[model samples]
Target: MDGKRFQNYEAYFTILDTGEKPITQEWLVSLIENHENNLQYAPDVWREYIKK
Candidate 1:
């Protein structure tokens, strides 16, 4: 993954585990939108993963 995208995932994981703060849906959407071109899987894949 690109550095920016990796950082975004890391931030999300960190927040998820630590309860430092909630990761906003808008921020997650923005991160995916920003890295859409670089993603190996489509956004639907991520949505499915999140649903699980």
Candidate 2:
């Protein structure tokens, strides 16, 4: 995966785990939708992760 893309995902995950601030589901969905084609790995990865 590209460094920048990984950074974005990591940042989001960090926010979720820390719970310092809530991230909306729509915002998370939008992030994945915007980068669905540009990031590495198949879309199934995102689908599976988000589905959890």
Candidate 3:
């Protein structure tokens, strides 16, 4: 992932492991929306991760 653009997003993973915050359905939806919005700038980057 692009570090500068997605630094806080790394917290998504930690939320589950650390239980510091809950990952809500709305947050997941926002994450997908953010990625979709970024597709114009980085389709290849999106495809690379989506394929995995």
Cα shift from native, residue 22, model 1 (Å): 0.8
The lDDT for every candidate, in the order shown, is 0.47, 0.46, 0.47
**Candidate 1 to truth, TM:** 0.27
Encode model 3's per-residue lDDT on 1-52: one tens digit a residue. Answer: 6556643443333112323444455545656787555444443433456567
Report lDDT (Cα) of residue 51, candidate 2. Answer: 65
- The TM-score values for the models, in the order shown, are 0.27, 0.25, 0.27
Error of 3 at 45 (Å): 24
Residue ranges of candidate 3 with Cα displaced over 4 Å: 1-16, 35-52
Residues 1-52 of candidate 1 have per-residue lDDT tens digits of: 4545433343334113323444456656667676654333334445546567
lDDT string for model 2 (1-52, tens) is 4545433343333213423444456555656776554333324444455667
lDDT of 1 at 48: 49
Off by over 4 Å in 2: 1-21, 35-52
